[model samples]
Target: MKRVIYGLFNRLRFKHKLFLSYLLVIFIPIMVLGVYSYKQSEQMLNMQAIQGIEKNVDTISESIDGSVERYNHTIQSIVYNKTFQKIVTNDYLDLVNLSYDLKEYLTPYLNMMVMLDKEIDQVTFYTQTYVPEYGDSVLSAARVENEQWYKDAMNKTGSQWFFEDGLFVVSKFPRFFADKATNLVYMRVNDDSLFKNVTDLAKDYSVAIADEQGRVIYSNQSASKNTLDADALIRMNEGALMVGGAESFLVKKAVRQTGWTIYCIVPAVQVSPNVGSIINATLIIIGACMLGVLIIIWIFSKTMIRRIYSLNVWMKRVEIGDLRMRIRSDSKDEIGELTNRFGTMLIRLNELIDELYRNKIVQKEAEFKALQWQMNPHFLYNTLSFINWKALKSEAYDISHIVTTLSKFYRTGLNRGDNIIPVRDELEHIKSYIEIIQIMKDYSFDVTYEIDEAVFDYTTINFILQPLAENAIKHGINRKTTGRGMLRIKAKLGDRTVEFTVEDNGEGMPPETAKTIMQNQCSGYGLKNVNERLQLRFGSDYSIAVESIAGSCTLMKIIIPQNIQS
Candidate 1:
């Protein structure tokens, strides 16, 4: 049965499998939780709704207090206004000037108040003056003295809020000039603007603002009186109240800034409607969230699958010795770093392969040369004898010296076709080349050798010393025409390396000329060739150092790693 199920699963497409997994992992849990929550939350819906409504009412109460406090702050700004106070009490001005200048000075203050508070429908200042009216916002004290708002404002000590004609009147008397002139500033709030934030809460509910005396100040429903069941209100707690009808639920909040109460009279059936809607909304949101997650997962999985497919293709190529292949990845993730490391490893592997192939070819060539050397010994000796006889017959001793030195040079340099030879054989090869050079130049310089016998048994690259000694002669000694040049060669055994130096007491080279030997920019092929072969044998760690001072001496030092042979 397990095998049958596995075969069926394998036959499904990738996208189908993914969608089915999402349904099980994501959709099923959400549906279960939604059903359970709907059943459990239905019973407590009414209580929670009442609590939410109470919180909203409390927020509305806070907004009302903030509006009242802002109005009070505005009134205080005017009362403490230095310019207004000075202008009102200024006796230096004539009556006409005082009236005109006071209205002109109050222009900016009135415009500022209108700009700051959009709820302020009109602002007015009334003073004890004979002028009946200056504008809609300025008035004479006598015209307003009989009005109830003015009487109410005067009866109180400081700022007060009064409602009239569906508007809120916040009035204050400026105490700075109130002794000589009864100056009053009134900020009127439009009724619709006052309750703008709570408009949605009042849509299906009857909302009212009631004063301390049970008189309604404002109501969203015109027919509903501000009067609630007085006994029910007295018996209720701070957050809730029960009306007489079973279908009604009331929540009230008291304004701390003013002795007023805000109430919401919602039908009990409204709470059940919201419960069903909330469950449906939650299910829809869960479905939408799952869809978004599926889309993102699908996109990322496809991207990763493509990268994996590309890497697999390259790996197959590498299995067949095709090391030139690479994966294309522009990302900085761990996979991209892995791709880069693989590329570097392939490069190193290719280098090692080439080195092994070349070494095989060199081994074959050395074996062929050894066979040729075994066959040519008598022939080589006869040729050198014939050359020496002709030179002695012509009475040319230099020609005899050249032939003899050349024969010895080739015999030591061959070294039975081996690439690594002992230090003693390398020194013999250098000595033979120097002897031929001395005979060629008629002995213009003297060559001395200072070799450590302990290092004579150590192995070194064949023919390495001859080039360096030849360089010291050609570039260092040969450049001096007047003085008798001196060539000194030294060999020493170091800690883990062998050191060889060639010094010449002749006209030395410039620093720039000495650098060109290693840079391969000079015409001195001998020094450059020796440096290259030394580095190839023992990495870049072994090299040649050329040091010289103009018109003094030149030194060429060669350093190589010591490899002891059995």
Candidate 2:
């Protein structure tokens, strides 16, 4: 049930609801007023028509009654007068003479009464017998030998009257009669202007004259020619002659005097016409408003959601340690202000990260300087004292050579404040160390230098090459079989780089020991430091490698750029 109700509400559009409301407001009044107007117009027109007709008919009836009384007096004079009785009794003067006397006596009276009756067309006279003398001078007798009046009058004569439609005057004398009379005098009456007068008055009414069965006899307003069902017509009826026939109407009225239906038939459909058009226009306006509202809402929501999403992305980046991330927005709303704050926060975070990075590099640089400072002069001083004592006893000229080399060694090893020194300087320091050891142990060895003259200007870190060379001579030369030993320092250009190889023929370690020296970089801090410093100063590509064969020699290779300067 809840689902059903939700669907129904969704299907009912806002414009439809609004249009429904407008229809209620406008059409409801129109419907009510239309119904009321129809009824009232019908009754009003019908009642007015009936009242007017009743007045006219009453006037006609009164005039007719008065005229009939006068006619009866004239006829009584003709019927009972002494002159007519004597004329008939004597039989000397014929009935024709009596008719002439009667006609002549009645003419002025008939003319006056005819002029008085407004509905009368003309006046005429008839007698109990045909007589030229009794007729108007311009007319002759039109005998009605078989008329009902003739038959009735021949049997018994008095006065009677009846009405007929479409009656007309004759060119010749038309017989006047009682309802049925030829043996008595008669008069003719008519209302020629009655139809015209009634028609003129009906112009003001929405009036129609319908038969008792509701067939239209005449209508005042023919534009809205409305037809009525028998029952619908019955609503307008009160009595036998009351106005009737109001079927479909916009406004209606009744005539009180006649049974005619008067319809102010504004079409029932015309009552609330164009209602749909009004509703359509209302719906269009409402729809436009709603569309504008929706567009505004969508644009606003999109901007807001986009700002939130951008902020979310920034937050995620910050969480993941990217302090450079920032949210950017141009809106003047709260979200834009929040993004501005976030951008400030990112700036602060980046500043903090940069400070930490700088501190780390500073500490690292300090540590590296400390590691380089680890090589001490005191150990060399004590070892040189022992070499001095040994040289004095031997008193060999080579002792002086050894001491002189020692001085050069110390000079290059502590190369003032300079971190890098010339390669030749490093070679001289190695020669001194080897010479001093030879003076002490009397080791027999041959040293040779094979280096390019152009490579002589290139500089490397102080004491870098000498220590590795010392390790080779002192440890490698005595450990081997008793034979001549050779120390060779060779520098050659290979491709774009220079290869500096220190080769020695000694009791060499196995390939595994060479492997250990190559791979186990931290095994000797001095060698490790030298290699690291060389790589750090130059690049990782500029570095050291050790190669050896069992019982032959070890070769240490140092590669650097051929064109290396400072």
- Top candidate on lDDT is 1
Q: Tell me the deviation in Å of residue 346 in model 1.
A: 8.9
TM-score per candidate: 0.41, 0.35
Off by over 4 Å in 2: 1-396, 518-525, 562-566
**Candidate 1 error regions (>4 Å):** 1-38, 43-55, 58-70, 86-93, 106-122, 126-158, 166-182, 212-214, 222-246, 254-259, 274-566
What tens digits encode model 1's per-residue C-alpha lDDT throughout 520-559?
6445336666676677667778888999998999998988
What's the TM for model 2? 0.35
Model 2 lDDT tens row, 523-566: 44457666766666667777778888778888888887655565
